[model samples]
Target: MLVSTLLERLQSDPGRPRLTWYGDDGERIELSGAVLANWVAKTTNLLVEEYDVQPGSMVGVNLPVHWRTVTWALASWRVGATVVLLDGAPEDPAAGNLDVVVTDSPDSWTGSSADLVVVSLPMLARRYDGDLPPGAVDAAAAVMTYADQIIYAPEPDPGRPALTGSGVAGAAGNAVVGHDELVPEAGPEEGVRTLVDGRGRAADVLRQLLRVWAAAGSVVLTGPATAAALEADTARRDRLVATEKIERIA
Candidate 1:
């Protein structure tokens, strides 16, 4: 229900910029609300149709703080699946009790005795070309084949578990935040453009990005930054806000 509400709000303003991501290799990607919703829909369909991931399924996301990570989280929540954020490969994969594990590193999960879905993390959302790890599903390839719109028989329950961290300290869902209070940050007047330090924890970065979108703001994220790049970014945009553990400049 919370995922549906967020998608509906995003659909209301399809043309607005919701995410703008920059990779360490200098690749840049900008996605509108509609585009993001489409990705989420396809991902949800992939989970439901391919993996049979139904409500209450535990979906592990072993990925960095990237745009696709956000899409995967939203898709899992859309189908009422509990999202488990993993910083890296699980020490004992079976010990996590995950129904499905999605990761950019297929090799890491190949030996894990659990079902694995591999994400290429391509800049253009392209599928991997060569041979994949044994018994691993190509998420980008599978997701593209799904419908862009999702139609559930019975809508997902809002009170169900939505998100959990690798540890027990990071469990939360619509029940914790409530439907009306999705994000607590102040809404940006025009739009927010912030520089996020991707080196931080993936869950923290994800929560911050969601907060920015809830405030109707766009993000300009990067993995670590050089002084020159930071200066250039600050000079180019008057509303740019830089977020780093050392110092946050607005």
Candidate 2:
């Protein structure tokens, strides 16, 4: 299904479970499918009516790994906006590459190269409570945090894939052990690069994909500019897969 279809279904369905969010601090936030749709719709209104984020516009997201990022990214895509991940204020102001930058910290700055209409990430975060900013979507990305600095870790060897049984998957399958799941204590090889721990957030990824696909919604993975959204999205998906509702593809 397409992204819009998913949104429409959720909007029409008034009662389907949508999210199973696991915070980095080990917190859990559950959102019904209907609730998620309402939040996204409000977010979309904020982007369109408030932020003026029209179709084809580029919006930057700078949030940590959290559920808020997911809704905001989905909202941006819902309005046909390109979600740009920002590492930091661009080094130059003349770059003029972005239309908006979403940040959580009020003091966050992107730089002069990429001019942005800066806004608060908290604004989007509050959407869960149904609070949205007035002039949002007027910029490219929200003022969120993805943290700029990349740490290189050695990749793990690929292991055999196996089927997990009942009681084997708990708290989103954090316990299902696998050979490839191990990570090296040392850094990566001279030319090798890894996106994250490399234990395969497949469980989480699969869940998110399934939900989104079921919703048929479009999502932007902006790990380059505002990796916070990307990282958060990845983590959330991992949790969903581990929740036991996501079955491995045969």
Candidate 3:
């Protein structure tokens, strides 16, 4: 029920900015609560109707710390799927098996025999422009065809495994909140604009963003921002609270 709870919170403030993403190419994206929830709903439908992702299924997310990744995580949790964070498409024989793998890499699953989903990571959430690898589904193209509202037959269990790390342990939906709350003061005030560094592991960044959302705060994520760039952007810095550390800017 973690996904539902978060969605309810977001719907309560539909117009507020929940996620602000800055791509490495300087493209900016802002998703309000309502917009984000709609995307989550569409994604859930895609997983259920297209990929047949159900409860107890393992979904490997081999993407970066992008807004689409957040959408995928929330959608997977909504259907009671356990998300596995992969740096890229599983290539090694020792990478272990997965029910499904989602990645933005162009060459992912090029010659492999795996169920892979490819995302374009477009600025407008558009489909990929070029040719896609064989046996890989285009996520952006497929997801848009799903309904905005999710209509699942069975409800998801909160006690089921929600997320699994690369080498670390897995956590159930009921325990995800506790895990995010482990960092003291990591949660920001309501409507506060918090800056988060996206250079760390995708899982870590996603966890931090979840904490911010739990506190009803908006996030300003940057990719490898320099201290000089941070200082130069006074407008962005002034909106941020002093509690934000310098390391976060870097």
Candidate 4:
């Protein structure tokens, strides 16, 4: 349902900057709806063509809250694959049925049984600089090679699970969310321009972005760049709101 809305918006507002990021390393990247859509399409192709992620197949994602991770989640859903949130280290056995695991720190998953796709967090990354495992795919490089639009039709079951987040050790767990639970449309267009603090839980951040986009809104995701500086300084935070023309902070 969310994916359908996104496809519609991509055609209508291709130039609108739907996702903007402020990196901790003094960098800013903005992805218009069309651009974001292209990345998602490419990722979907990578999942289907390279890994054959069909409906009900699990795809583990263990990465920080960033624009790239957002793309991964959307793409995983596009192909009817269940997006499973893996807690960073791969040693945990909460969800072992994952067909592929997309992550930044590939070292942790040294001998992971599932296929690994190592990702570089930077927006401009063409390929991962670090060495990958024997069968691991360099997602930064591979994603670019895939087609920019969806090549196959995917009719996923609405009753099947879309996302699953299992707790690792001491952390709280989350319940399975089916496609039916993903509401087709937001109540009304609130025109909310959200300022996202990147320190929140990964699943929560992804859900917030999905809701904001579903409402036909935009997002300004803040990395450690503004989160740390604005944490203690109200004045700085106010200036950011003014500078970014933010309507809400998520």
Which candidate number maximizes TM-score? Answer: 4
Candidate 2, residues 138-228, lDDT tens digits: the string is 3224322221111221122233211121122323554332323321122222211112221223333323433443532322222222334
Q: Return the candidate ranking by TM-score, descending.
A: 4, 3, 1, 2
Candidate 4 has its poorest 10 consecutive residues by lDDT at: 166-175
Instruction: Assess every candidate by TM-score.
Output: 0.79, 0.49, 0.80, 0.91
Local accuracy of candidate 1 as per-residue lDDT tens digits, 86-125: 7667684322778888888777676666678888787665
Collision count for each candidate, in order: 0, 44, 0, 0
lDDT top scorer: 4
TM-score computed on alpha carbons, candidate 1: 0.79
Model 2 TM-score is 0.49
lDDT (0 to 1) per candidate: 0.68, 0.43, 0.70, 0.80
Tell me the tens digit of each residue's lDDT in model 4 across 74-152. 8888767788887866666644777898999999887778889999998778889888888889988899998988887
Compared with the true structure, the alpha-carbon lDDT of candidate 4 equals 0.80
List ranges where model 1 is wrong by over 4 Å.
Answer: 92-95, 167-191, 225-250
Model 1 score (lDDT): 0.68
Rank by lDDT (best first): 4, 3, 1, 2
